[model samples]
Target chain A: MITREEINNIALLSKLFVAENEMESFRTDMEQMMQFAQCVADADTANINTDDTASSSPMRQDKIGTSLTVQEALANTDASCDGYFVVKKNG
Target chain B: MGRIEQIHSLLCKKDISCRELTEEYLNAIQRDNPELFAYVTVTAQEALTAADKIDRQIAQGGDIGMLSGVPMSIKDNISTRGIRTTCCSKMLADYTPVYDASVWSKLKNSGAVLLGKANMDEFAMGSTGENSCFGASSNPYNTALVSGGSSGGSAVSVSANLAVYSLGTDTGGSVRQPASFCGVVGLKPTYGAVSRYGLVAFASSLDQIGPMASTVEDVSLVFDSIAGGDVLDSTCNRDYKPDTYKTLKDDIKGRTVGIIRQFADNNSISPEVKSSMNEAVKTFEDLGAKVIMVDIPEILRSVPVYCVISCAEASSNLARFDGIRYGYRAQGDFMSIHQLICKSRSEGFGKEVKRRIMMGTNVLSSDKCSFYYDKARALRQALSNEFSRAFSQCDVIIAPTAPTPAFVKNRVVADPTVLYMEDMCTVCTNLASLPAVSLPCGYSAQGLPIGMQIIGDKFSESLILNMAYKFQQATDFMRTSDWGVKL
Candidate 1:
């Protein structure tokens, strides 16, 4: 079972903040998932070679192509300035 | 003739205008969408505008494509230039794309009218479609049950006749399982067979946008339109051609079908699903096709491998949803950008999405990558190799799409493991990167629909479609009316 501390660490790594109130249920769910994930953890893959490119796709020409204009690119954002996305100030 | 041909004949004879047909679908959607929750956004105005263009072409004695003037739904994950393309998650609830997905562009160029954006599992994560933040899309056959998901709404829309056909993305069994539960036809093309340019990435390696329709012929028609290579999606095969429509009616008299014996013998399979499989095998035998049992022991590991790999990919794919660029942003006092991203993701994502992301992050961590992530990848290759060997002995493989028909919505939503297990029967096809289709085979004792899947080797869409078409012709299960959906 995954402990609350481990759950918090995972949430941190995932860039998700788990509130104190929701941590218990979150930990419980994570524990269940880890239990289910044991199948992969226990599989025998020592001699197997991973073929990541089994479904490899074609490569395209490295040339300029039509893309979203600046206006179109930022159209969905609520905060932008000078063609740049705005975010919270970092410490 | 199928619905597409019927509509084409009507348009050619000037018996009905495109606007009239669009209005009929729009009216049905307006009346039934509330109860069904199948559509997240209806594009009545846009559908009419596109339909009117087709009518003008017909009036000028110009030829239109087979799908011209036919209204269809697109799963919310596929991007549309102006339509709100939410993946039924709070994170992207208000997001719209600046350009259309390649599939959407192909259909648009073919003059197919867009009906609306169908609801789906949040980020296409869950199997029951109940994970949608917008609310679960109920099965049209029985509103009390789920429409198998993450493509549930796409299947439901076609089942209910809310649209002539709909497009959905399948990662694992998203398309076919739901198609089975809803009594419709769902096709998942060979990996990289259809372009994934504008499809919201769930698992880049496994995701393929496919079509759901009432008949195999209609599914083939839509597949022909949206398929083929695209420059934007480099993963798509450059030499791929859309030929399902031309060979859809071809005879499958001597075709060899491999039935995996373990899938049927598994205790998890419901009696109804087993009976349905037995009947489907009999039907195939009666049709003069050779049926043989093939042993594929590694198939049982599919679900676990799928979960590990998909979650790992999803973690990376979904990392772009931080508050700065787009999607839901958390509003509060934040001392740093990191805090803002954390809060935004926690608040914006649903429970299942968060859980998967955490699982993914954990599995891919330095300490666990070799033991878990890399092992899963190796197992994936083994599974693919097993499928290749199996296909060498048989032209196609047949299996139950799901262990059971659509279960009660509340029961499924209450348990995440149950929902995950629902993909047991269908995920292996995706893992092997094979072209597979699910079509209605029979109805359960309780009247829920049962689906049988036909999986073929890579780029064998025409063969799979031909076999499915033959099964459909030999049975009436493909007809929406047989499933209690009114025409």
Candidate 2:
């Protein structure tokens, strides 16, 4: 079960915020959803033989290719200046 | 003839100009879109320009390709340069890509007209089209019912005949389920059969760009056009191009069709879906195919497995949307950059997207990682192993594409878990990275379409398409509405 505090913590980690008005319903939904997720523990997976071997695709040879120009790349936002996206200074 | 071939014949024979065909689709969209809500954006001028070029080629007595002069829609999630690719989310409401997704580029080069960007669930997140920020697309069969999602608009475009065929990204049944609901064919190719170069990332591991159309032959034609290795997408499977379309009419006689053990006695599926599955099995038998029951017990837990894996992948993939670069940004003074990110994300994403991100974050957190995230992966391995063994006994597996047909709008809005539960029958294909196609087997008593998914082992699209072609030839399950251009 998720407490109100745990909801706040998860929200912070998720880079999101939960309003006080929506917190109760949101936490309830998450708790129920997590309960559904808890079904994984019920499966007989302990004896099922499986491995976690990582498979990596072969990386293509490094070569230069045509890419979006700075103007085109930054066209979607007004936060760019001098071919770089400008952001507020971090704390 | 398949819809694409028929349209192609008309163009090649000079019976109709491509410009007139494109205008017919554009006019249909203008008339029906406000109610059907199939398209998020209609690129009329672009479509007509492309059509005119195809017309010019045809006037010069040049032979045209199958997809030449065919009008189609691309799911809004697939990037179309200079056109709005919203993914049906407010977050990227004004976002347009700088380059075309490989699938769109492939179709564009083949002379397919773009009716517009099709609507979908926000970021391909929900099973129902209602999750789209723009609005849910109403089912063409019954306007009160939903077109299943996150490829709802793509399915609607084909079902309502707004476009001949469309491109939909299937990241866990987004393509097949909607196609099933809207009474069209959807192929979710093996994980890398189509390039993911410009398709917006949902669950990167599970996402595949696939073809949706009115018939299996048309689906194969579009798949032939789009499938191939791509330098842009390293993971694209190189062996699919110019293959399936050639063998589409091959015999499925003596092929073993497997039915999952759980689905045999499952109480969750509606009576209509079960009835349709029975009829589908009979049709396969009549076509001289053998039917066998295979046990894939782990698939019973697929919904949760899919939820955990998809949400986890989605959390990481969506982290790119910081207000600084692009997409929706919060307007206000913030004490810190972190505050801006939190505010922007909070306001930008829908409730479902935010919930998933939060749940994913919790699962991947230091303390909870072992319980949720790690456990889910091991279970996934077990699921994959189950599919591998099942395919050893059968050429393809069949399951009801969904537990039921399309739901009425707002039916599951009260409980998000109800929506999650609906992915049960379709997610296993994604989990195992297998190619699967959903074909209309029959319709419910309510007159909505019921589809059966034919799943093949990795890169076995040829067998699946051939089986679908045989089934379509044997059964008369395809239904269309009087919504789009008649011709």
Candidate 3:
């Protein structure tokens, strides 16, 4: 069972700020979701295995086909420095 | 003739202008699309201009692409160059992609008239279309019932005769389940058969763009046009091309088909779906086809495996939407940028999506990583192995597409698992990366439609379509969805 504090903690982990009006609804919804997820938890996977390896196509040779120029790229975004998409500083 | 054949005939004879046909469909959208809520954004002017060009080409006796002048709707998750692709969520309601999805580009290149973007489950997460922020898409058959989703609008548009055919992305049973509920043919091609370059990521490994149409023959025609290799989509199988689907009209005599013993359960399926399957089996058997029954217990665990893997992948894939440079950003006096992302996502994503993201995060958490997620992965392997063994015994497998007809609206929303269970019948095919088609079967006692899913070996779409076409010929269920016939 999820306590009120646990709900708050999960919301913190999920980065969702539960609104005052929505808290009760969130709590109820989360409990129902957990029950649904429990169905997955009930499966017996004793002898099963997983393939977690990442696979992808071979890297292409360094040849430009089509690309956005700095002006074209920055034209759409509000933030621009030499026409590239301005992103936040990595924390 | 089918919709595609009619469009081709009109173009070939110069009997009608492509622009006229495009305008006719646009008029239909203007008249009916609002109450239907089938489209998210309708590209009237652009489509008309494109049709004009195709008409010009035809008038000049110049060769045009196979799908010239045919109007089709695309699921909202696919990026169109100038059109807004909201994925039926408030987060990206105004977001427009600078680049086009590979499929959109192909359709545009083929001169297919774009009707507009269709609605879907928010970020392609839910099985029912009700999860959409735009609005719950009502079934064209009965407004009280739901259009099965996240590709609900795509299936609904075709079912309602709003568009001849439409595109839908299937992750789990998004395409086929909706098609079943809408009483149409929804084909989820083998994972890599269609390119995913433009489709917004849900679960990358499981997502596939497929055709939703009124008939298997129309689906085959569209499938042949769209299935091919693409450099933009790394996961696109280099194998599938027009030629692969072109040779699929042969008889199924001497071909092997399998019916999983577990799928025959009366309790798991509605009587209507079971009877439809029985009729399809008899039709297949009478056509000189060999039918066999086998039990694959691994299918029972498919739901759990699918949930774990899909949620895990969804968590990772959705990480791109962090209220950063693009998408909805929530600003507050007390919060930092990180807190803003949290708040933004919390507010932007709906209840079901947030729940899955949390479940995925929990499974991927370092402490319980191996316990829940890892175990689920192992089951996925076993499921794949079971499919491999089943395929070794037979060339194809047949089962009910869904347990029953589309339920009344808001019935399953109170408990989301009921919605997820809709995917139970369609998820196994995705787990094994097999091609499957949901063909309209008989109708439920309540007069709602039922469908049977014909699953084929990986990349064996030809055989699957052939079988579905034969079965469709034997039954009249597909032609009975007279949503517009005015009873």
Candidate 4:
């Protein structure tokens, strides 16, 4: 069973708010998916070593490539300050 | 010939102008899309513009490429320069990408006409297309039923002849499931075989942009057109590509076909799907390929492993959508920037998207259960090894694309666990990062399409497509939808 506090904590970490009424159902769904996930632990992974087996992606060329300009990047937003993205700092 | 070739020949011969073909498709979409909802944004002017360009080139007697003048739709999750790419979520509902995804750019360069952006489940998170903020795409076979998703619209467009073919991104069964549901051929290429440069990220490791169409040949044509080395996507392998379309019709007589005996015999598989698999086995045997059972005891665990890992990656990938940048931004009072970001996401995303985000964050959180993600990753390796071992015995493995046929609307809602089970048969390929294709093997009693997938080892697209081609040749299963358009 998942406690409400755990749900609230993760939601905080996720930077999203769970409404007071929606918390129970959210916790329930998380609990059920988590329960389903427990099956992975039942598999005996003794033969596998997880620490040393990181998969590496190939590197692209280090040369500069064409990318979105400051204007193009800032075109879709509601807040901007002379080509830079903007946000409120404090109350 | 594939749809791409058929359209190419018509243009090459001047038998039909590109504008006429483009008009027919646009008209068909206008007539049918009200019921099917396959396309959310149709690029009519762009398609006509491309078509007119092709006509002028033809008038000048200039040679055209294979995909030139072919009308096609792209999943909205793929970024299109100056076109809205919603991923069917309110968060990016009005978001227009400033750059084209690599796949779309490749198609554009090849002169493929853009029909529109296809609808899909929000952020490619849901199993059913019903999760779309716009609306679910209805199955062309029966409008009351769902077009399986998050690539539902891609499948529906091809099935209903809204477009000759469409691009859909598959992370976990998003392409194949919808293809299976809509009675079209869909291929989820090897993970790195196709570039993921402009696809809106769902789960980076599992996400791959693939093609869907009414025939295996068309699927191959679209796959070949879009697949190659991309400097933008490092994960895309430069040397892994083989000319799959050239070898698409190659002989598979002596090749081995593998089947999971347990799944074939399991009660979870509906009677119709089982019958179809049985017939598929006989067909392959008749073609002189040996059929055998391959064992991988971890087959059932693929879904859960996929869930844990995909959600975790999605959480990280989607963190870029903070109210700061180019997606939906919230308005109103807030104390801090952090609060503003939270409010934007909470308001912008739908229920299913929020659920997935929260679920992903929980798995990655500092809680004791964060270990679940690690174990899922380890088990993922184990599963891949098991599949590799299975591959050593057989050239290709066959499995039902879904346990049953497409779900009637609301039938799969309410229980998230039940919805996840719909992906059980399809998630294994994503977990292992292998290539798989879902083609129609048969239909349910109600005439709903049933799909069976042919999975190959990493980068074995040619072998699987050849086998699928051979199977399609010998059988009269729902090879292509016969809804008014033929290539």
lDDT of 1 by residue, B1-487 (tens): 6788888888989998999888988988888889888899999999999999999999999998899998899999999998999999999988989999999999999999999999999999988889899999989888888887999899989998898899999999999999999999999999978999999999998999999998888999999888888888888888899689899988889989999988968999888899889999999998889999998888888888888999999999999999678899999889999998998899999988998899899999999898788888999898988888998899999999999988887772444666788899988988888999999999988888999999999999999999999999998886544222243
Expressed as tens digits, the lDDT of each residue in B1-487 for candidate 4 is 6677788898999999999999999988888888899999989999999999999999998999888999999999999999889999989988988888999898999998999999999999887899999988998888889899999999999988889899998999999999999998999999889999999999998999999988889898889888878878988988876678898888888999999976876788888899989999999999999999988777778888888889889888888888778778888988898899888888888877777777788887766453678788888888788899999999999999989898788773455878988898888899888999999999788988889899999999988998998888888875455553554
Q: Write the per-residue lDDT of candidate 3 for residues B1-487, one digit (tens) a residue.
A: 4567777887888887887777777877787777768888888988888888898899899987667888889999998887888988877876788889988888777788888899898999887798899898888878888899889999988998777899999999999999999999999999889999978998987999999998888898888878888888878877667553465568788988899888886487777788878987888898888999967887876776788789888888887777655677655543366676787788778877887877677677787567667776677677778888988999889999888889888873566566677787889888888899998877878778888899988888888998888888777786544443111
- Residue-level error in angstroms, candidate 2, position B389: 1.2
TM-score of each: 0.98, 0.98, 0.93, 0.97
Please give, for residues A11-74, the per-residue lDDT of candidate 1 as tens digits: 8899998888999888877777777878888987887777554545566678987778999989
lDDT of 3 at A47: 50
Better of 2 and 3 by lDDT: 2
Sorted into a CAPRI-style docking class, model 4 comes out as: medium
Candidate 4 has which clashing residue pairs, if any? none
Q: In lDDT terms, how accurate is model 1?
A: 0.89
- For residue B6, model 3's alpha carbon misses the true position, in angstroms, by 2.1
> What share of the reference contacts survives in each candidate?
0.79, 0.71, 0.40, 0.77
Query: Which residue runs of candidate 2 sit more than 4 Å off their true CA positions?
Result: A42-53
Clashes of each: 0, 0, 3, 0
The fnat score for candidate 1 comes to 0.79
Model 2 C-alpha lDDT per residue in residues B218-252, reported as the tens digit of each score: 99999888888997898886655657878999998
